[model samples]
Target: MRNLLLKLSPFFLLLALFYHPVNAQNDSIKILSYNIWNGFDWGKDLDRKNKMTEWLKEVDADVIGFQELNDFTPEKLDAWAKEFGHEYSILLKEDGYPIGITSKQPIQLKTKMLGGLWHGMLHVKTYGIDFIVVHLSPHDWAFRRKEAEIISDYTQKSVLMEENSKLMVLGDFNSQSPFDVNYDAQNTFSLKRKQLSDSLRRAKNGPDAYQNLRFGSIDYSVISKFLSLPLIDVVQKKQADHNKKSFPTLVLGNNLSKSEFEKNQQRIDYILVSPNLENQLIHAEIINQGTPDILSDHYPVQATFKYIPGK
Candidate 1:
């Protein structure tokens, strides 16, 4: 009986070496950030939502941070998340334009700030990483700057608390990145400022709007603050050469002509990570293919990071 058991041990060892639990062999986690265009067009387009679900399943990200979840409740988002294989979800608030986080792993809400921010910030912990999802003010650069300062203060405190913290801050900034030099070279900044001025004049809020636009419409202070936190911009770092335009995608309800859209296109969505996670970053992209291009006015940004055990 002892000899027989010894012979079977080799087969058991072989099986243990060959089998792994699901993604155990893959030491990477994919994080995605997207503003789902007013909650999948205000939750009125079911077909679009279905298509988006399919797309999410295909992406197979470990976690996703969302902005502009205007009409989503926690239950509604949970149901949608299950369809795409996410078992855990959390919403910032039910009223106004809320943000959310959904993950394949369990999510623990750390912070939800709604009083001082424009759209608000939703912070959660999952897979041992901290994610702060934010949507800063869209109409005023100065307001966005203030919001960025608040976020910076919070993030700095978190970083100081732990030397090896794995943290990320990402979402629709609604402001242009200073890293995208094309905006200045192509005069896109001036064009957008002119467009803003025209709209404000039409609304008869020209003076106040002009005062807010004093910084010349294309402000870098918001993004610069995050950079100052020493967080790495994953998309900028990985896809440095590509045209990373993430906004004004071809949507169902927009009147912008092809040329107009091209001129107005900018990369507002982002996925930023702590410097500690920089070496683990394998791939980062602004998703532009297939359903994403037509599903929302803003394209999603994704970053893949290799998991380090016991970090």
Candidate 2:
């Protein structure tokens, strides 16, 4: 009877650890991705920074992924994180522009791959989840696609090894979803019309414009490549209303002086997570209440997720 009891003790201990209340709440977290428009022109954004500070406190995010942080020194970023009450920070600075991550919990910086990538991509582990924050090429779709391939390959390899590790990819992709091609056709066509030179127009939609504008036709599949994996866009998949029309993160045309932008918008920023993490998604939102110029060209995107331990 004593020997049998000893064997059962091990099983019971395992159950106790698995069902502990402490472990239950450790996995739930809130994440935010914001493109602060760190530097569109060569001016300063001191007032904007203050507004951002207020915004950050309002969001109360556990983890934050920031992109287009042009000209932020390590010290400045560190201070910014501290001001927001985050205990950990990782900054990837490149040629004055920097991308970064801040977490209230401890962060284990993983291997930083794809060095020399135009904007940058950051990989880290926090709250028992792996994260890849990226700000891909904003100008070229082809380049963005290649970058996505590299990121996808890395994610796939990670999954191959762990199989069920929670992963989240968040940032400003600067591209559109392939699924929304039909909705974007009108906007693409109009943009193309304005881009044609007089000589080019005489040629009547010449091959150069067509080739250069080919990306528009495809609706920019950069995000699609990443989504092809087991990952799902938290807002897109859960928020059915936003599926039909693209929600513009970055606003363009007019309202610049007054810190506003035209109503026409584009949904380029995103937060994507593994299927398991997707199941835990509570809510996702794009924050765009403040004046555009003072707040940011791109709105901040936030998502709430709860971790599911052991699959």
Candidate 3:
């Protein structure tokens, strides 16, 4: 019947294509976004990579978005995905660190540059859904904001064309929500501004001026842009109308030189979906569990959605 329809006409062929299901699963689907520090090599031990494999197996997500993958060859990642029971994979094959997407189901590549920005942005179609994986700028908020604008404009155009397609953008944004400023008046907001200002001055004053420099916030722009699109942030949406303190995806250790100089614990990782998929969202969370302890400075974030295969 499908072959016959294909021979009929282009219009009928389109109908025949639409009749087929877009995804394999008919029920719940799990997606995860993780920044494994410097790929799986952060700890400089093979055991760290082994632990990550075991952890991914345990999480059992159908799709995963990974960032900060250093020294990862296609063959290595392919072998890793096979261990996790995923047959499909794609990586941003380029210099410096890159991002990737791995899925249990088949996927087709859409875009890799997201308007030709730094770090990387990936677009893939799989599981009857569209996934955009990204690792935004980490050091400068201004750069991140610019990158976010590129993504926002591209997303707006893409979403308008296929309004009903389930879309998810997930990865290590290295950014935080501007709305959190409401609760960060004293600690988060003021301190970060001071630090940024000091750093700017230090740059002008030469190396000696950076002697007392400290890290500060610069991720607000990306989150703000996504929110403006009215995209549904899995965790944020779940916490709406409640005491909304976002769980920290990036955890710091006690090895810092001074307590005051320590960077604030914040959630810079996220999994956001289009507004159309809001109701399909089951739940989302940041995974920080382990027997000894989870490896990597950034925890993995997961989101579950009720599958609605494309007709």
TM-score of each: 0.87, 0.76, 0.78
Please report the candidate that would top lDDT against the real structure. 1
lDDT of 2 by residue, 1-311 (tens): 99999989999999865442312355567899988775433237676687678768776788899887777766767788888878778887645567889887677888566564667778888877888999887545556777888888877886535866888899988777765555455444334432453336437756443232343344466777877885787877655433322334345445333222232455678898888776688888666555433467677788887645443
Clashes, model 3? 0
C-alpha positional error of residue 63 in candidate 3 after TM-score superposition, expressed in Å:
0.3
List ranges where model 2 is wrong by over 4 Å: 1-27, 39-43, 186-190, 193-212, 215-218, 240-251, 255-264, 290-293, 307-311
Query: After aligning candidate 2 to the native by TM-score, how far in Å is the CA of 158 from where it should be?
Result: 3.1
Report the C-alpha lDDT of model 3 over 1-311, residue by residue, as the tens digit: 98876678898777765543323455788899888778756336687788878878887888999887787777777888999878789988745888888988788898878445768788989887889998886555666777888998887787536757678889877666665555444335335645877678668986455321224433366787988876778877664422333233223444443333223455678898888888888888766555213467777778888887752
Better of 1 and 3 by lDDT: 1
lDDT of 1 by residue, 39-127 (tens): 87679988878888999999898899998887899999999999999888999998878999999877778888876789999888888
CA-lDDT, candidates in order: 0.81, 0.69, 0.71
Candidate 1 TM-score, C-alpha based: 0.87
Global CA lDDT computed for model 3: 0.71
RMSD versus native structure for model 2: 7.6
TM-score of 2: 0.76
